[model samples]
Target: MTANANRLEVAGHSVLLTFGPGLETVAEEIDALWYHLRAADDDGATPQIRLDYALPSGDLPAGAVPLPARPEASYTISGHLTREVIRRLIGTRLLLHAGAVAHPELGILVLVGASGAGKSTASSMLGRGGAYLTDELTIITPGTFALTPYPKPVSKHDPELGAKRDLALGGLGLRPAHEAAAPAPAMVLLLERIRDEDEPEEGSSVTRVPLSEALTRIVPQTSSLWALPGGLATLAELLNSVGGALEVRYREAAELEELLRRLPPAEHAETAEIEPRPGDVVTWEDTAPAPGRIAAVPFRQALAMESGLFLLGEHGAIHLPGLAGLVWDLLADAGPLTFDQLEQLVVEEIGEHPESTALVRGTVSDLVAHGWARRG
Candidate 1:
């Protein structure tokens, strides 16, 4: 919106950064933010997110700032804006926090782990074999999990590389997978780096993992699983077709190179075609439950346990625990019940109270209003 601004298009979303007069001192960081998207046009109406950054008269935000200061300031402000833009584009795609690499023919291998688990480091070591998909964010379409490369600069950390250097793709001898030839992900590895004392006495190893465990470990890698329409269902189908996943435990980054080379190429499964459903349809209200039984929506099914319920639907997989899980289980199992029936169920389980009836009815009303449950 301002005259002094820079704009870029990312994942079909436009971002505009408006700079204050004195803030130009950190132009390098600002420019780096738009590394891949810089060539994009800056049409005024095209911007979906607009950010304003300023620098006071005291000092510039360049090298004048503390060692980690410049990286923090620029990375935080610009990175936040970019991450927000991508999160909003989750309707048709998925974002996993991982480092991905192609294996010439084994398709894509996504390395997932918690923060400081050595994803970036492992990717750099494995870069020599094939294309470097990403060292941070892995963007892909559902069902197939065919990785669409999001090749932002790699954030590298190693004793020899100096402290926190953001290296280019070539610096690590890696290149992004070409879109025309991008490969569907063959397998996903849940990475865990071990300390000297914790390293496996037999050395590093890779073992086959079950579908349920793979899904569990991968959930934390997803930043917008709940936002991706039908995301939970899509992931289940994708993992099943991958022949499940492998859990890799390692004591060194380079040790993975040989193991990655020996892994077999995955058999690409046909992407399941699920007819799209209306995610926002509503047929219930806050009024008291009617005489008819309530049922989980056809497109929405939930798995419940003692602690919580895992629902897979157009909305997403939601974990409802305690009261939420209790009510969900009642409605989910008993079909649909009248207000009186639901009230009795809640009281029988958690003990009776003066407001128990009202609370249970209110909970049912909310679930109906939210498209989670409906009268049969």
Candidate 2:
């Protein structure tokens, strides 16, 4: 769709979105939902979306349809349909209801949490000086995160905060005009509202939790988890690709923003040299083989090293830290090396030293056992 077709624009990107009459009542609040994503400029285009309803509209808009009465039925339908559309149009793999904003020259800060977890409030506070990417759902694909701009105007539950930002529904023309989606989400910050502020910040004002812990909260907050085709496997892969996850605890929105600014960028933990411990989940970059090659594995499978070799599930070698060095040496020959050829290269690189050989052998064994390498 062309930019002219949309009415809302933030940071030169469109936040246009459409909802059938079923959602007309809440249409005015959509912009407040996306107030935090005004500064996102990773890409110039906004996400395109079309809402299809399964129910009939009673007093809704002209094209309104009624939604099923089942609990979560609307969310399920919206998420599933949107996911398919995003995948086909933009290659996005995950779509989440979250908040996102960018730091001047640095990367964007994403806020993800359960419904009513203060994502919308926090996003607005952060957008005061920065740009807003989104206040609701964020779509994640490989390498990019597109924010779904709320078609409606900003709505503030806290009248005080709303007044502070000059955000009045009628004043900002906060009405649903068209449905437009932003880029996919880049980072995900799982927010946890804490009653006590006992934990001291780690240098930076924000208290950051481990990636795994963050995922526990993030997974549940997703638009629709059980509906995904592969279930947990698909969820796991998404968490793995996201690389870093954190649980943010803060009461005030401004405090949260300050804390987020102190955090660093998310890096691919798979590339790091940190030794993997039990319960340590890491992301490893691997591509599917040919079309006929065994059906593709979901992304979240844990990393396993059999006898010290690394591999992903029942297929593909894991070229991580220590193993990567060995793989580099093997590829030095520039030939189509079989598993055994690669193993031999490890032996040559580390020599006959028992400890080194054992480590290298274990790593290679793990790779083959996991279906990372096919017998040549």
Candidate 3:
């Protein structure tokens, strides 16, 4: 490695970052932002990725990747580095677009949500009292549920520049990963930031989200979840071990610490086996199916809950609620059924309704539209 090169140990992968001459200022900023990931000594760990940043007009190395010549080049480089590392971790870890913080006795509690859902804020706040694992992405080993700490610098929105600035944890008065104790997988919290207009009088509270609904909410927050081997089945197992998922709807990040601490540790339970099946390709388009068209569900896996069931397809998992669940069960065993036949079955199940025709037709169409059911 050259003097301008720095090695980052990110998510168990070694990344070597090299910069061309005349980019010293940007290189210094990158070094400071990723100071937590700096390797102590090169242990000869083969570099998984080597990032070469240079001005577009500057002389380039044989296979060096160039960084955009802009004020926000560091931010862009940070995002690119994260994506490349996550790409390499596709099938190995169950990567959630979340933040993680330790709970002293309860181990690690992951804040699972999409971007702008306040994961970084919650992690920054909650981690003040405990260890901070990460504030962007949470990496967990499937089955065993072990966490790989990737406490990358927290990105703070800079109003002056109208862009985010990656600030070191020490600067923010939060404990860095190196200073923290080892993390153990424990709980999963789905964050739902309640807007003031949505009736703040109701107040903030934490409630248990249904396992089926939780899966639906969580599936979208994952990074390339389908690439993972067990997919939904593995995720279902992890959720069960964590005593399902809890939804925390709060107006402020400060309220979470005391409220979450009051909650008891989840009693891990044995999860039900999710059956994986061979899936069939189904094209999704606006074209509605004919009334006589036969619809069949070719599922990758199926997880049944008390209220609903989750059908995992090649693309993503679809939550089948009430009649939809029954219809999937019917199609899974009864084989292919025409659209008209399905409506009749739904009518028979509910003892007929004026809107049964539209309801059943819409349900089947949705199934096919989401690639959950194939039209034959």
Backbone clashes in model 3, listed as residue pairs: none
- Per-model TM-score on C-alpha atoms: 0.65, 0.43, 0.85
lDDT by residue (tens digit), candidate 2, 1-376: 1111122343223344444433443333433443443334436554543343424544444443445444333234334443544344332245566766654443556778876577767766655454555566554443343444432233234454332122433343223212344433344677766544554552323444443344445655564433333333343444455556656767666577556656655544332112224542233344433432221122233332221222222222233345553553244233345545555666676666557546655755554465443223
lDDT of 3 at 343: 74
Tens digit of lDDT per residue, candidate 3, span 197-277?
867577788777767778889988888776677767788787877777888888899998766766644534333545644
Off by over 4 Å in 1: 1-9, 30-36, 40-45, 56-69, 157-165, 177-181, 200-202, 264-331, 335-376
| Ten-residue stretch with the least lDDT total in model 3 | 280-289
lDDT string, candidate 1, 1-376, tens digits: 1225667654445677666554554546656644655534644484676565655445544423222324445545545554875667577777788888886756678888988889988877776668876787777787667776665567755467344646656656776554532566777788878777665465677777654456567876776675677676567666666666777778889788667666544433223323324552322333334556665444333333434555655354455557766887776556557767777888888898998867776777776676666765
Find the candidate with the highest TM-score and give its number. Answer: 3
Compared to the true structure, candidate 2 yields what TM-score?
0.43
The residue pairs that clash in candidate 1, if any, are 293-336, 294-335, 294-336
User: What is the total number of backbone clashes in candidate 3?
Assistant: 0
The best candidate by lDDT is 3
Candidate 3 deviates by what RMSD? 3.7
